[model samples]
Target chain A: MFKGKFVDNLPKIYGLYTGGFLLFFLAMMVAEKNGVSAKMIGILFLTFTIAIYALIGVLSRTMNVSEYYVSGREVPTVFNGMATAADWMSGASFVAMAGGIYYGGYTYMAFLVGWTGGYVLVSTLLAPYLRKFGCYTVPDFIGTRYGGNFARFCAVLVLVLASFTYVTAQINATGTIASRALGIPFGTGVWVGLISILLCSMLGGMRAVTWTQVAQYIVLIIAYLLPIFWISWRGDFGLFPHFTLGHEVARIVELEAQYGLVKNSAEAIKAAGVPAGLAYINVPHAAAPEGAMAAWKFISLAICMMVGTASLPHILMRYFTTPNVTSARRSVAWSLFFIFLLYFSAPMLATLSKIQLMDPNLKTSIIGKPIDQVMAIEWVKNWISVKQAFIADFNKDGILQLNEWFMRGDVVVLATPEVAGLPYVVSGLVAAGGMAAAMSTADGLILAMANALSHDVYYKMVDPKADVRKRLLVARLLLIVIGVAAAYIAAMRLTSILGAVAWAFDFAMSGLFFPLVLGVWWKRATKEGAIAGMLAGLISGTWYLIYVGPAFMAKTPWLGIDHLRFGIIGATVSLVAMVVVSLATKEPDAATQKMVDDIRIPSGKTVISHR
Target chain B: MATSKHEAHWNDTKGLMRITLALWFFFSIVIFMFGYQLNSVKVPLLGYPLSYYMCAQGSLAAFVILIFWSSGKQQEIDMKHGVSDAERTED
Candidate 1:
């Protein structure tokens, strides 16, 4: 029998959530106006928002295996889509995506296109069939479909590697946001993020995360939109942010070119008196290469990101929570729409922030001014004092030249409201949104890695007949262990946030995407083929990255592909290996073909029995 | 007769899928291959560059429409061939 919809009484839940958030927002506003210090206000905002998420996690906690693993497969369509959207849009998408565009110009649009295009592949190639298969985890699908423990174990290894990288980046973003908001050291922020992430995921498993993600979507969307809406409405763009922002982007490009030319000239470099290597600080905005080989890097990046999007285990795991195949298919559309709202606005916000940065007021003359005088301007002084953004005054000309300024891209969105002279509360709200984005993603990643370990590796391989109670307990313990490990790595700051995310996506795409696709669509695909292909992809992808990643970042391309996108080559190898090996070996048996046929149907019936 | 007919219908649906996926490949790849070139050309009325618009909003809209289209069409194909789950429930 079908279960009753959880959101059927959505009105009550909606009223409570909306009313509670409003009450909290008003309290913060009042407290700030009553002369609460900015640091205290920010701490209150971050603490309150994360606390609400934790409370939601506790309320939705469950011990039942079915509920813990996949939320009992009862989440309705609309809510599932919202949860999926929140899971898909990690801290990187919410906080750093626009900042990427701000820093890298047109080349960075690859993230938007590649990430969004990924959902199309998901709905078409993966979701419905996976839903019909009624598996609890990605590795469940792999193990059952391939009819071997080796394939399942391979999936677990790939899932852990990919999701761990992703979760670390989210934890790192959390650290940065929490540090800025609470005025604490970065190390402490990582611990705070780790505790909060474990709290949301360890107690209830997927059941807790599903509803908390819905709550997070609300917080993140509101927080993301408010400042953009403010900036758009205040600026000449009127109410719609994306409407007139094309012109703003064009203007930003123009200014970049002007500054770029000036920075590159001998006179300007001599005026700055910096080292020759450091003379060119402004990267040209329109550096899309015309050469075929160079352009291949862009194409490779786009493809890797797209395939990686569909390959992510945490994302695929969310589709398993939907009620039926029909709903699973519909849910992908909903996820796309919800994600579009933020992604569409990100570029517009990026352009607007750039315009504000280049405004006459903020770009004050520091030339000929003493160091103290140069540091007096509020934005300049704050950034320079913290060394977050710097002004070297290399010429000691006392005037701030464009080439003399350097600001990190990650600060663009966080500093936008400040640059626009918005109220201090807006910055606090942005910080909360950033936290929600990072925490929501962290919750999903930790849960996926835990489920893979407990279900695929431990339950299936180690203790095949373990009771649900034992399995669930093991899962919760694994969640806590993984959370601490990822947090420890995040605190070390081994890689930049965006760079780490790129690695995670590329690894998943290379190792998992093709195998999963071929496993479903190709009847000729054998168990040996799947296993060999996966191992080949993972080893080749990681090896290439380790060997050539740094040089690729320095603008040297390996075989016309950036090191970040070497996954494309790895995926090609995977595809070819699967086909060649599957042909060399015998086809999958008739029963396996029958299983594939059974899964391809949109029937509500579960063909496979409970593990 | 009925089983063989079902086999024929499944094959036909598979054919339709190939066509649809080909279109998706074109949009995801061919469009991206020319992304820079496309971006250089602006849409007159929209005042947005083609590549920028496509990456930002156009492809998303296409994806939403494509999923619904494929899902709906696949359902119709199943129903017409007496292969839908609803047919089983009726039995």
Candidate 2:
């Protein structure tokens, strides 16, 4: 039973949905085997997945404000975990993770550790307390906790800034997958992504987004695991994939010595479509800092990601859907478990796929072959035409050396099935899964941003008297508007998908992380302190990103803190400002302080006194 | 709101978090700080380089376990303190 007392057999429902999706996929594969073109299969994958999610959105459309905003807080722990995993995975995890590791090696391992480690903080420091506080949105928590609109208003701004950056990256990823799979233009692809994302979230809001995300997570995890399993079996990767993954890495290290390839460097592999040659564009921060700075940069980046996970509006919003504080705490564990399936396998996929390309003993070996022959391979040509990979005979040698192959780290997962000679159905399945990953993230993000605007701003501040329908209408309209804006930014292709995502995390980590954490733990934290901290963090982090980043290139990194890890600086400034300011000022009133103390208990009813 | 039982519950929860977070930080962060150094050690039977396994796989798995342990334990503590939602509803 949901919090609203609705009764339904969720596992049975989703089980059938997954079964139907797989059957439809098999039927499409059979169609492909008969006479259908690859292009037709691609189109079917994109359309069918989007159609299902859109149908879910339409079916779940709600007029009730509470249900629309937080799914009436009745979501079961397991389902919420699935939805949160889907929401958290985003385009960055789905498309770029395996590729990021493929090129960057151990350095990109930070993303996995950082991303999952953040959930520990979520379970312990935030989720249960936030659920007890019972806010519809993150900004709602800030506004209520600090006892004013100004603190809430600052949160709203940060939410917009962080979520917009993240949503744009998700849309950007969808565009890339769309173009590569269907041969559609990237520009056209983003708009399609926007329309599909809006179709789901614009109607039912969080209720639709939550259910849709659970379905998406299922597709994405299956899509992600299938190719890894397929290629592992083909290559005899191992009795268990994890053990063989380590062996494969050792083999790769052994081969690197044999083939004169440099170890632990993207420069060694020459990752394609990463904008090394684009003079006008800012250098996408895909290069892993190695040598003396590597360890420090890794720790700092992981810290940002860990903090960002606990702070990101869309992710934290999922916990609010749980039935109780205990469920909220329990769901974060489930969320971590679900996300781990992909994180553990991403390294395995990176290893297996690289081994496939690296080992001359394997049939799929492309390197060490003549350049002309390698270019003629079908997947290579398709990836090139889609602007995902690049190659050149730099030394005028006919042989394709390891350094000659260049590829966007974003497409490795998408391209792996075809590269390993899996069936066309696997490729179709991967594309749909990639879409589910991207669209689920986008829907959650767009809903978060719209809720910040419509719920936190319009309903709470500007028009407190607005009725349910009016408030929801405003939310729906904001979703479409924000979706289109993110699509437009994504179409520009300003930075790599992972790079933009890092920026979004830095924004969340900088501005919201401390305020939210401190709010729950420290009853003495005053209203003025939260506002000061939020502003200080927002300004400092953004300032550092622009100043040291490719935008201006005016200053060198301060204390090894680059544009990619601006959150460290912002968060440090925020912590100081908040702590100093709070001690300088009088503590919050007794009633508010009492409410804060009660939120820690995680029993009884939600603390709704702020209303 | 600041009753003795409520205060004690908060104190107990804090103790649990301190322990949980210490293990979390050790696995997910402390190991990574000495990342390259840890790469020197490899598991014998499995052949996983320790640092690589920890960074890419082990830490993530540890996090999942840590979360479930903390939450399950926290729920027990909540019940013991008579502040769990189940206890409240039963009342």
Chain B: TM-scores of all predictions? 0.83, 0.89
Q: Which lDDT tens digits does candidate 2 get at residues A207-261?
A: 9899999989999998998788878887688756876666677787777667665
- DockQ for every model comes to 0.39, 0.59
Error of 1 at A200 (Å): 0.9
Largest DockQ belongs to which candidate? 2
Please identify model 2 stretches exceeding 4 Å from their true place. A1-7, A262-292, A609-611, B86-91
The CAPRI-style docking tier of model 1 reads acceptable
Tens digits of per-residue lDDT, candidate 1, A472-570, equal: 999999999999999999999888777888888889987899789887777778888888788888988887777678744354556867667878877
Off by over 4 Å in 1: A1-5, A261-281, A284-289, A361-374, A394-397, A551-556, B5-9, B82-91
RMSD of 2: 3.6
Question: A372 in model 2: Cα distance from truth in Å?
Answer: 3.2
Q: What is the Cα-based lDDT of residue A564 in candidate 2? A: 81
True contacts kept of each: 0.32, 0.69
Candidate 2: residue A378 lDDT (0-100): 92
